[model samples]
Target: MGLAKQQEQKILYISPLSLGDVEFQERNLGLPVRAVNQEEFIERVFGHFKGHLCVFLKRADGTPSNTFYKHSEKERMYKYLQTTFGINTYVSYSTFYQKVKKHKSDILRTQSNIVHTYMLVQDLDYYKFGMTDAECLQKIGQMVAKGELICPTFIVSTGQGYQLIWLLEPFKNIAGYTNDLDWRRIQDHMYEQLKELNSDSVVKNPSAVTRLPGSRHNKTKNLVYGFLANEVTFTLQDFLWFYDIVPVADRSVKPKKLNKKKATVTTIVKNWNEYTLNKQREEDIFIFVNVQNERGKSYIGIRNWLALVLRFHALVSSDNDTEYAEKRVKELCEIMDMSETDEEEILRRSLPAETYYKQWIEDTWDRNKYLRGGLFYTNSRMLELMDAKEDYYIQWKMKTIKIKNAKYEAARKRFEKYGEEEADKHTWEAFQERRNEKLASDKADKLWQLEEALDRHPEWTNKQLMEHLGWSLRTIQNYKKKLHK
Candidate 1:
């Protein structure tokens, strides 16, 4: 019983902040406030943001190095905040870990890992400055009150120190790189401004994770808590008022055109043995293959995605000299566990190697058409089409695709209950279903017209089909194939 009492005391010591404490603080701090509790704090701060919100937890029983790390959508991370409240908790101020494992020790918490940053934080260790927590808080309040400092969005009292957070509209990385120069410049300026208060300049990077509010500071034996000091979310320009830095958001930087000549199916296949893929291209292929192999389910969209990947690969791989990619796709039908209809559908949807080569060049080489395909399959759209699971994305370097898929599934399920809610009837899925049905009807009508035209002129060339039906070369050819079969 004595041992049990000690264990109970330890648990309470770790998580001493109760709901009553939250209420008492809220009542005492008479202000137009927010974040009465930890959950409320998380929701108010990060509920709207997408991408990975990392949580770091260090337990009393564990060594300093034995910290727990988790990354998930901000909505999902709310649960983590509750589950890890007893431990010493910290959270990435910006959502980092773009393309990595859901949970791994090697998970990136570097500046490069920061996909988007929504806040700038200043760590004020009052003890280092020989000040009390109340004195530090009163000082910050006085600074804001006197217009010496802009009001922080929230001020977290970290038991011994304070963290002042200035929430901003998302400052996303440009072209996969953080706006390092401008970001750092702002950080430096902010630090300089608050250096009198002993603001730690070291924690100014985009990767910095702030100690979570409403968690126990094991050494200090005090509860960490925060309250909203300001409601307005600042933009990048707002900070520029204090810091004399140019706004990185307004830069009209175009992607640099590579010096290499445009790749053609003929040229690539002719020099297939000598041709080599760059690191980016190789990585793309590797990720695609890994995603397919791990999922092990060849849905229609999944198979078409496979065909698309192979179409690019075929331009550099040797086979039957011509149309090798298509042939290879056919040979793999049995291996892929695809039905005859599935194979035929995949083939029908698959564009030629030349077309794929053209699109690839446009995506990689042409600045205006960078990463744009005919279907405009954005990362999230492609993931949804593949019916990707949360685990499949770890190796693919994708961020927020799992969260997006979840949202899409939720929207779809909501759409299914159309009669229950008026809003559900107008969902994107419902609209897409309607659009697809109309498209199918239109295609059937067009096919009937083409069949009639073909019956009248049985020996009609593809040129004749184009002239008669007013269709493109590829469309007429596809219709011709359909008519013949």
Candidate 2:
């Protein structure tokens, strides 16, 4: 990870229930601030909005704790939280209770995995001689590269301190996950490793939650934002580094070096020409927009979201899958871990799939184009909006939730005065303007990239260059003629 993305706004959640209330605690991010789940919390941690979300409450002794309440009791917990205080529902970093196995006396022990790996965004209160944020980051970089320590996936500047969020790519790096008890052991191992570097012991427990990026620090009066979403995502080796895992080196990543005078492939994007319905280009555009691969990422609700995206494509392109889209969508969703009843019941047939699709496509692909997001960035952006993270069925407002587009103008406009009348009225207009600019900018970016490629390999023909750059011969000719002039 190069640099972790910072807080989207300057705001911290304040607990509604005081010490007397059942769910009240000293300091919680007032429950789910910006994250739909753990990954979003890690990616775009900060949001300024306030909502009633339940974080894991601590024990009476003030010790950090993680408790896996039963599925049947979740509704009861929700009602309790809400009736006592004005909270919406429970939002947790951990997974829903899953049965691991049966024990003696026919008892079932239910446990859920910690879905998101974390970095304590701490201000080093324990140490008298504390390091600056920059120094801490530098020291971490040095430590990881030494072939000794597990590298952090990203770093966040909390305004008060820094958070080195741990890396769990493809969601499998941290294995041997059985239940909450197992996770506590894992957390303890990690805490022990980082303790030498001044990791705070108080919040190191498995169930602890941090504020989203935009949440304000009441004490410091400062806001946190993305310090960096590291360009260097962790490998199995990095995770293994924690367990003292060895012998097998993780897959090597070739460094993508950019030319000093020109932008790199990471910065260049395809020009938005036209999306002609049913044409090969349309099909390609659909695939390009929807199916971009995000290497080494496995998050919750993946299959359901894919079904939604693919179903939208089927519905829009009547010639394709129009006959059995509903049936097929259920099938696809099932393959991705959803139950048949869930596909039918949870995903209501009467739901506005079209409006949802348009909203999603516009918010995501449109946002990505404007940000000049490349493949990985674009895919990551898409992941943030699926299912619960999406705004289609917005039950409660969040701090930051627009995938990776939180940094762009399209996202910023909504946040300017978020819940205000102006934000509501002007949001759509601003979005369309940004989309139009992206359409123009992408074409320009493409041409610029083409020219840089041509300049480096002068002897190459237009056809060869077209093959190299995945451009059409006509497009290449048009650009060449324009460049020649």
Candidate 3:
């Protein structure tokens, strides 16, 4: 689904009680190393959320256990956790409750079972990288001052590391709503934005738990406490700006120069362009490489290989919709002429290894996996893998394979007309050089268009420019900085 463009930030209407007593008490608070007790911190962070809450705690027998309780029973839950010394506690941000399903009461916490997520979390563990707490805090301060990072609503000190919380107006997680995808995009963007802060990548899952504020750190024996940064709360749209941004290709966001003692934080962005293929591209490649009509010479063991490919795509494309995914996988298997036995085998394999499958899918994030550090196979390598004939290229829909074929045709024509010397200009290296030149030209044209729009409407506000030119507020600010300078 296409994400809605964010032209401006929108603040939710926060009630006085929703602001909590922590914000009231800390009206004059600064970003100092202050901490609050268990009760106050928990209420301030989770008071707005409704229904049953899920938490992980250490039992008296030293076994780790997770439990769900009604919001009114929170006091009892807290008592249970506090009874055990050095007991670590963790909490999930997704709001859930007990429901009667199939004549049994169950505590549901799956992605679909969640009503809404009241906050997004960033697990910042600087100590893992040998940085002290004070050093990490100072770097965060510098980043905020330079407008390089968004100030989190609150910060939790987990004895060894920190958890940054961005409270949001409860965003619905229903199937029909677009919030689920937008929420994922926003969370992923935040992870990328704060990678320099050693943000934990795996904590972005909706039902994933992190250290609970006011809980004890098992190893350090220090109490985990939270402090107020501000009373700021956001709606889903407030974070729309980040979702619409595309990371600059093969380039790092260089901060302004500073001396040794005051160096700016260097942002080394992963050029996703070089590392990952989009969902459409991956699906097209899978079909072109594996699908066959009659299954003759390539028919030997092709059924097993096709089943694996289909299962992989189902896991990635289903968006946690298990029932739909199951049905879709069966339909696809049938279309590919796989027997019912093959279909059942694929589902059986998938059921036992959902977690491991997710890990395998993420392995594409590894920069050293494929050609030029891409997550998927290159067109030439794909062709090599399938032993594809020239006919396969003619039937392909995605541009990657078609572009490869075009280059081959171009080179053949050039060599026929003007010998090997002129054909050298159409080689891969020369092709890349020409592509880079075109990209640069397009960037210049965009900047020129922005400048021209500003000249025609000198009195226009940022909002007006956004509405007129269809650029994000951040994009407009960036262009203004460059054009004025």
By lDDT, who's the top model here?
3
Model 2 CA deviation exceeding 4 Å by range: 1-93, 97-127, 170-190, 202-204, 232-238, 241-243, 246-485
Error of 2 at 412 (Å): 56
List the global CA lDDT of all models: 0.56, 0.39, 0.57
User: Model 3 segments beyond 4 Å from truth?
Assistant: 1-34, 58-62, 99-107, 175-177, 242-485
What lDDT tens digits, residue by residue, belong to model 3 across residues 204-294? Answer: 6777777777678887889887766646676554554333321111211121221223222222213223112223433554455344543
Worst 10 residues of 3 by lDDT: 1-10
Clashes of each: 2, 30, 0
Can you give the lDDT of residue 68 in candidate 2?
45
Error of 2 at 476 (Å): 31
Q: Which candidate leads the pack in TM-score?
A: 3
Q: What's model 1's overall lDDT?
A: 0.56
lDDT-based ranking, best first?
A: 3, 1, 2
Residue 396: error of model 3 in Å?
46
The true-versus-predicted C-alpha distance at residue 32 of model 3, in Å, is 5.6
